[model samples]
Target: MSDELDLLRAADPAPAGEGPWRDRPLDARAERGLNRLLHSRRTRRAGRRLMLRAEAAVLALFAVLAFTFSDAGSSPAVAAPVALVVHDAAPPLSLDALARSAEARARTAGAADGPHRGSHLQSWYMSMESGPDAAPPVTVPEERITRWNADGSGSELVVATDPRHPGRPVIHDDHGRWRTVSDGKVLHRKSYPAGSAAQHGGLTARTKPPTDPEALRAHLAQLYGGADGTSTTPQLLLALSSFRQEWTPGPRETAAIVRMLADADGLRPAGTVIDRLGRRGQAYVYDDPDGPDGASDATRQMVILDPRSGQLLGLEITFTKDQPDFKITAGEVMSYEAWLP
Candidate 1:
């Protein structure tokens, strides 16, 4: 009994550092932990014994049970983790249907170009709320107008603005479109580009895109991937995205691309969302190769679709996990773009 009492005394943990709880008796849970500690210590001090091993097992089991049956009021009630359920009511895959509808529109649609103008205007809206800089991110709600037309010929415009305000944001007015980079103490400016989602594919009066889905898919696969086709989800997504960046698919081509996308792995419907152009569109997410359940550090690519006209409206890239490097929070918009004709 004396030896046991001495062991208990040594295992006492009421006070971690000779404080108020130091001399006090341990709680039920604490007692169990301390008892295990005491036995563990005894095993170390004296050579391992079968009797001691059995006793240690029995004590460990009791400790676990004590934790299991701990009084609800005595300890904080633990909430059962809720598993997030997404896509429960989502529609079945409809890439084929969407493509067919797009092709129908193409049949009745105007020529790829309204009229070959001397110069075509390229207006791109960008939402780059976060970037890879160390400073607090600035929102760039601005449009970039390049002299280059849809046919892709033009000189680069270089405008000089105040370059001193790296930490401050530059905003462009919708009415004026003029931005002030810096004015000594007063400083702000406009924004720049996020990659456009649905581009005219840089197809001009001369370029021809494949109308067959299989051919289109292979063409795009070769364009984005090389001789060895990319079967991975992220690669296919980026490849399709690359096609949209330079070319706005004609109706038939758009339909074929949509059909091919149906079988492409890693793409899943994320439901409807409004594009930057304020158009209602269906949103699809390309989840990371990692498990879908991991919210943190998971990354996704977004493609917005116009179901009625089978047009690809926008594209977005966001993170499910917080990105400290970019000073972005989880679910924060990384970059979004809506294309315009």
Candidate 2:
């Protein structure tokens, strides 16, 4: 049994190269060849791994570019500008130049024509003051210019009062042509009627109503004190009715008002201030003269803002006397309407 086991062990081939197959222990040259084969296999595997990584990187870059381009393509197209056609013979003026010319025209015409000839009407109402021991406050009904018209040259502006009086219409014929007549008496008479048109140069027209209510209101407020204050409510209503009839505010007027307000310096001070209604962004609180006394009144102006653009909307003025002895008498809202040229 021992001889059989020894023969079987000897027949096992002497562990790869020890017997007949190798005839000797593996030499250094053979060992080197074997090592080279192993190295080649490892290098080939590493190369395959590197190639996979490179392919993945390239794929990732392409995916990023695809996403970017797709997103860009999905964006909306920009809107094109609309064309405007002018019928008058005058050359088209740039917005800025037109505004300057319009202002100059308004000033010159206002001076020549005298006060506006709109019907002067008013109504009275009573309300309580804010103080603990205060008397009832007097409030005049809302006064508005119902109708207004400008001569072809814009030299004469004829305005009919809301509460038109029983007499003849007020005429402001300052620029000749009987620009305006009130009860046979020419409220405004033009010295050089024929030549006055030349002073206005070319007549630029408005295309739409003014959108900025704030500036319009402020302008109207400034002009408020200059007009006649005595008239009936019905008459004033009539004047307001005329505003829609005679003058249609244009988009250019609105744009002009917005620009004016934006250009106004120091409209709001550095520090935060509460408005008359104690709300943020409601009113701009400022200082102004207080009637006869040297004392000053805190003037709070409520501004109407455009909801979409967050722009100044309109303005309301309220005067409160800081002096302990004096009472506040003026607190009114001034509204503005854009008149088309």
Candidate 3:
């Protein structure tokens, strides 16, 4: 029993005493909701399997219970949904304006033209696996750094850490055991020899990207590898993200990327916001309701750029609707990547 409790502690996503509601007792409505959830057909089936794995079962139960009673503490439901307030008063910056400014900044900075050889980034991404034995869906946060030397050798390092919550236990799955570890725990580290670093499917790694805005747009689509007859917005965003993973864009390349995005259809300026790395950036968004040509998922994609230099800052994808089978909720972030300058 002691060992079991320790495992539960390690797998707890939210440790006790963290949130305002942690100390508050559940209201009557919330208690009733929890009872219904525990006895539901799906819960019973899951509970049978969960009995074999106390940690995963409890983790899944907590996730569902939290969502079920999230609004229980608030006032009773009303006829209409409440409207959210936007505090920022400044108007959203237009894509065209951002493109022009980025180009000007690139030229003024006289940055080298082309992709840089490395990147340092922090990321949080949802990992979901489905099966009788699969663990619950989880979002993992970590920091990754990759560097390449002039001799073509490079190294990669990944650490489990969330900068926003320093010293907090970082959750990770080791084999089938969901556990927590101290921040900065080294998850992976490796060094590569010359010629090995260039082995990637990235567009920029294959060929030099043109600075011409129209040409770059076409280049992105040509290399996107999406099915024909589908919207390129989703594919382009993925390709752009892959580009960031392989290489950081230089000033000239940054300017071209901005200009190319400016002309892409369906993307609109989405006001400024602070990225996960604490840098303020201009945001642009594209919503894909039916997903790519044949896909059925609905998701929102966003690209954040440094407002001053127009360099790419971050990329995010989020689900806009609930997926009950997968234990996903609306407005849940699917993935986020913040590239450092």
Candidate 4:
């Protein structure tokens, strides 16, 4: 029992090259949270052997989780960290013009009357298996839905099912350890807390996004930029993750964001492709480096968009180099997500 837990003693995610969100450190408070998560009763339950490994695997994953996702005692187990993908070189297209087209379509449609409509986010997120040095990886196909009420309350529900089994979702027991159950109808859920960031970065009513491109750029820079106060590719990626993650955006805002992305560094047109939801979208590739050494652990992040309607279709990420310690092969998808239409 102590031997299996030795893996939990890891202070940093092994193979520094593999942990993606390397921007921050795990502080003492976060460490205590991990301790609680590891020592929970469910880790020793009879049927949760696989679940125990998963909880440890997730610890390996979040060791480098940014402070934004980690609270003192309560840890957010539901964060998809930085990601990228590696694929064929693409011919550059007039992404700016495409963004303009989408924006015009949004203006024509006008503002939606109520909260963003109910939409489901689906993805194959990478999950790790705790091992000797680095953890072995598995693809967790997850389904997510976030909804806002007319009275301004909302909830996010996430159901992760093993692709091999398909219906059983990986869940956490009352003791806060991961468990897999046979019920297809059961799901894990959480609600949006007041004053915290909204899923996909929706600003409050007082801070609704300006539809103009320049203004949108400033907004993102202020919201997602780094220490030097400049917006980088990674910050923009986080901005995209926080604000537009599968939730429907206003057409003008969508158009503006698309234009902003078109001009952002490292975006290359990957041409039109089908998303996991089977929707056709134009793809853009962003290879972001995580460490000071140029190109070390650089990930290829593919963001799919429906240019015609100007909606973001989904995002996928993959490692670009060999992570031998973790047994991670080059080009293996780290995570993938699509919105159900």
Candidate 5:
């Protein structure tokens, strides 16, 4: 991408050359001058004379323009930057105000409110290996629903299925980190290794929801490729891992996304229809941007739109990078979805 931009910048046309004689064509004069200079070996003086004439013509033009546009005898000067006294009256945003603003922006941008309405069934799969030889992969599946109460606070009920214990749902928090309540007793408790609790706590304290989908997409794209530059499941797992971060929606950013979607006339219709998946979300795939080698990666972006009001649901990024030899590794899908309270 950077290379392509550099190439475009380099292709700009150069300025036209100036030569002797303000009104006369320079082709005949240059041809005669070149032949004389080459044969007589007097190119330096001849070149200087030609340049002096061109400079004089430029000076004459500048003088004419200056006189014609003069307001007085003084020359025009650039104005200095003026510092204005801005009042410190701007108020800090309250949590309610932020939420309302985000909601309004989402509405204006045509974000549907469906995902927050009905029950949602979400399924996630992840696999990671520490070395070339490691234990078998781990898989997790979940089903959930988004329910809002009269007080505006909401809770999600998640029932996870473990392959080893089929049919028995392992109820857990929306985060999939804690076991859910059953019969008022803590039926399951997740044990963290020493120092893991501090790390998890730190993550919670520092995490803030992203309002910018573009930034989120860029982040997912980077993670999907992995830290060690390996491809495949690592990228996919990284994409899913983003959900752990809280999604704080920003009004202005959401509105901008909506306007782009509403005005997408030149864009080709996605090969796949934008349909609802996992109960109350709509999905659509689009082409990926060209990569470093001026070639488009086998990457496709999936954006989930809110099924209720058609607002942005979430974003999924998938792309493949070339591996050694002629083998091409499969890309992973990473995504972030909005969390409702």
Candidate 6:
């Protein structure tokens, strides 16, 4: 086995005796509910839920993870680190206004063609266990780079590192135990052979997303494949996030996405703020009163868009209320994705 896999195998996810929360009791029903929510494909695709399968105490939370690459090391280099910018209390900019501005900008921009060939992303993902033998939540910070050539060849690289705190130990799941590993570890790296059509991007079967606002909406709903033939606000956000993973939408597609989001229920503009990448963007939020599972809503979903180009800069999911069962505090981030151009 490779050194990285060997190290991963040596670590455990639930190290014994980490804290008091580890010994807390959870009934089977709640445990199953939490598990069902966390591992569901829709939620998992957006990094909206923690991937850990241990118990009911788990909730995905956020942290800012930044990385800087060095030419001297075997670890691959990446763009700058990700910084979590707190939502500002600026005047609300209506989604309608933002959408109009985006449409206007798209009209004036030069024509662009074809689906995006790759993506650059930085994110922080968390997994926690609350019951006996459970360890405190482990936050994993990663930088991923993907590229696809016209010939259908592509490569994917994922590295575990947080340059914001150089040399700090990174905790990872080593089997069932939580263990600390060195920073700058290359967790996964692979390249697709040329002329391989099986690894293409965009929605299933189709390689490009429609640019018409209604078409885009239906496109997303169809990809969702729910019984009602429609997507929830959370599901739409997750769908867009998944699309972004494979393709970076150009001005036309971006404008359509902005318009589509404007029409989504409960999403409202909050104000203008500088994104983590040091770009100014309009912020919109959706705080559903009823959580996805129909319980009291405990999370808020936020999307940031570049006002000038109307492109998405990032998406954040955060705790809106404290969950005593999961030991999560209000305002704690659940997960975040910073998409790079």
Candidate 6 C-alpha error for residue 200, in Å: 5.2
Candidate 2 per-residue lDDT over residues 1-341, each given as its tens digit: 23222222222212232212312222111221122222112222336675455435433433222111110111111111111111223342232343454444444443233322222222111112234443322221222222223443233322332122425343221211112234334223223343343232111112122334344433322221110233222122222222222233333343444344334332332222222222232122223343111224443432333322222322333444343322334443222222222
lDDT of each: 0.44, 0.28, 0.60, 0.53, 0.32, 0.57
lDDT of 6 by residue, 196-296 (tens): 53434323423477878888776655443221124467657766765676677877788899888888877877777676556787888888665534456
TM-score of each: 0.49, 0.26, 0.68, 0.62, 0.31, 0.69
State the displacement of the C-alpha of residue 215, model 5, in Å, after optimal TM-score superposition.
12
Is 2 or 6 the stronger prediction by lDDT?
6
Per-residue lDDT of model 1, residues 174-224, tens digit only: 221223342222222222233321121222212345777677666654333
C-alpha-based local distance difference test score of model 3: 0.60
What is candidate 4's lDDT per residue for 198-290, written digit by digit as tens? 332223212556677778666544332220124356446554553444245666777877887877777888777766555777888877766
Model 3 agreement with the true structure over 73-190: per-residue lDDT tens digits: 2221111111111124589888889889988877766544556677888977655543344334556677989887766688889998887778877766453334677888998888
After superposition, the stretches of candidate 4 with alpha carbons farther than 4 Å from their true spots are 1-93, 113-119, 129-133, 162-179, 183-185, 190-206, 226-229, 245-247, 289-295
What candidate 1 gets wrong by more than 4 Å, as runs, is 1-93, 107-133, 144-207, 226-228, 289-297
Candidate 6 yields a Cα-based lDDT of 0.57
What order do you get sorting by TM-score, best first? 6, 3, 4, 1, 5, 2
Best by TM-score: 6
Error of 2 at 241 (Å): 18
**Comparing 2 and 5 on TM-score, the stronger one:** 5
| lDDT (Cα, tens digit) per residue for candidate 5, span 1-341 | 33222222221111123222132111111221222112221222345565555435433433222111101122111111111111223342222333344557565654432122222434333222223332222222344443433333444454543323344444333221223323222322234343332232222212333444444443333322121222222232233223322222345444433433333222222322222232344344445454211234454445444533334544444445542221224454322233232
Return the top candidate by lDDT.
Answer: 3
